[model samples]
Target: MPWRDRISELPECLITKILSYLPTKHSVKTSVLSTRWKNLWLTVPSLLLNCHDFPYRQDEVILSFLDRLLEFDPDSRLLKVKVECGGSEDIDGLRDRISTVIQRGPQHLDVESFTEYRDDDDDNFLYPFIDYIPLSLYTSRTLVSLTLTYSGLQDPGLVYMPCLKSMTLVKVHFLHAADLEKLVSGCPALEDLTLIRNMNPIYADEKVMRVRSRSLKRFRVPFSHGKRCRSSVKYTLEIDAPVLERMTLGEDHYDIIMVKNLTSLFTVDLGIKFVVEFGVFFYPGDLPKRNEIRYFLSGISSVKHMIISDKTVKAFELYSNVGMIPKFNNLSRLEAVFPFKLLQFLPAFLECCPNLKHLILEVYYSREMEDAFELTDVPQCFLSTLECVQLKRIHEWEEEEMKVATYFLENAAVLKKLTLSLTNYPRYVSDEEIFEEVNKVTKRSPACHILPDWGLCE
Candidate 1:
């Protein structure tokens, strides 16, 4: 007998509670154990059916299982359904099951189809994952969060989720720009939105995708490395969100993204490795001109914290010739990844961050970068406000590194903390020469705390 047989002897309510803790698949699998466990999962509030989890099962078997599972349980209240499966498999049954769950007024709904199409006859696109989404989802008043991924060949016509607070669409095809924009505008209470791929059409009469929202606070745009080569149409994204607080663009994608009237925004993360070969009009980093780059930065000038990758640093170099970098008056924390030898431009960048209190540098060593730390004068933060510094990937002790570290130590009046870590994993920083050189630097601020524990890493 199984160890759980004793626990299964508890009352039906207690057994259902235990089953609720398990995933929908595992809970349903318990039916084979005994008659008592046959319908326990139906009493649970949520159901998650992932085809990947139950490998080698025929589509008919999966559909039959769902047919028995979703059969109307009068006692069940506030349903949550998540179905992850191949889009084209058992297409009719998948639609029926989804509709059944929606009719029950789900509080959270996620339907993902990993279906793919690779027909050479239609060679224009590589990934043709598609699903015809049901119209019933648009008008759901009970849904708090909705995530629809890899929806194929669907119009996404007129979404009206009045109670939806969070939404995510990945590889979901839309027919028009209005369809994409209306999804944002239609959700009256939406606070978070994520648009990953194919939410925009391959070509449109209009080159603008405008999203105007008052309640939105967080947004994300991510690009998949594998799908980068797949061709798609380009359009400038014009976002006008009054209360948005965070925005993360995975990479500086080819399309232009413009933000306006975002007064509450405080966090912005720009990922690395944008295609720089695109035209000057599209990608700001493509040329020495400042117009595109300047517009992108100025939109989030109110950001209080930022994380920038090396690609952005290089873009800054491209745009450095024409104009002054916008001063981030509210910025307090900055984390920058130094992939190339652009540390010399640190002083110019720091000039824009006058109120910055904490700074983190992640460097991958290049010999050219050693000579690149040329500061014409001490930055404003080094002299007064900058309190904390985190240095990552220090494999060897070099002159430029020491010079920059010593400069901060000698100049900063309010320096409170300094942390140093090595590049290699098992992540041991046992270089005595580094400690010896840094220890020799003059301590201008006695109140400054230097963390030397080898385990300390950022």
Candidate 2:
């Protein structure tokens, strides 16, 4: 047999695999390559179409392209399909074409609209005139991931995706928060979800914002404020995901009540907001209760790694009992921006985190006051398993810094390495000073390394 005849014997799976990586137009062009390749594009499992693939001067060009592609393989079961339109001609016809494509039971579908030039009347064309995402698309038992970007999703409640594992909604608005909650609750197998309210004209109040996902492992919700709305809406998020592993609460200032739920979480990133309010002047004896500290610590007991900002430390301490702090028994890694109050509570805090190994501290600097807090004695609650410590922003090798360094050098039995970073100035503590301190303390430990400018290492 000739070489051409031998090449024609390649398996269909290999041909489909080759076509899957190419653009939709390129994949479709393979139909004319040979008689054997004529129907190969029909079996391709993914389809992606962009406006630049066809000439935009003619309004019917895209429509004709879609018709031809669908006609070739109207019954193909696609794993993913994406269609992005550029010009505005017949949106109804486009929706019908999309509905026809989605009816083939694509496991993943994305549809978005784009234009090179901004139209003065673009605001009028923002709403998606399409009625629905046809029940046939959602009823597919194989659909695992679905994303709708910049599409008008008026009624997300009517759709139900049983096998959907991950979903992202960007610039999409729902008629009601309950409808959104219903949509999330309906997905029994959903593991990751992202809802981004970016640049939406419609605004909902605090009470109307809600979320409830039982099987969700990761959730991120970011809201953008318009000029008309200067203040952000506050809402209470009652989460009940028992199997959640990672969670991120964005820059929304609202009380977070974890309900002591989520036993499977390993990482937590909380963006807490703090405010000071003036009320009736009470006697110094009438102070606030300290249960807030207990509440915050109990919420993150299962987290092994935590990252907190500076502003939240004071609020956390104020809400806790006068002398009691939550014990983070399993905590191994911590990244925080330390405030003066947190520094003062360090001895008590480290006592609870007995298993801490890696500590990354980003110290805040203020010109209003000198270093007032000092660590006079070594902390007795030092971690025996502590290995590495990365200190950032060493201003002047203050009393607190020296005390922390000396305590770690003396205590940290298994410590193997220490990295001290100095910023904003050069050589606050000379090499002689560091070596002298190490000679006085660290008798049997690994070498201490100092990086004058740690930012350059990255």
Q: In model 1, which residue pairs have backbone atoms overlapping below 3 Å? A: 130-152, 131-152
Give lDDT for model 2.
0.63
Q: Residues 84-131, candidate 2, lDDT per residue (tens digit)?
A: 663444344667788777777778887774322233584655443322
Question: Candidate 1: deviation at residue 330, Å?
Answer: 1.2
Tens-digit per-residue lDDT, 128-170, candidate 1: 4356677777778789998888764345566788899998987
TM-scores for all candidates: the values are 0.86, 0.71
lDDT for each candidate structure: 0.72, 0.63
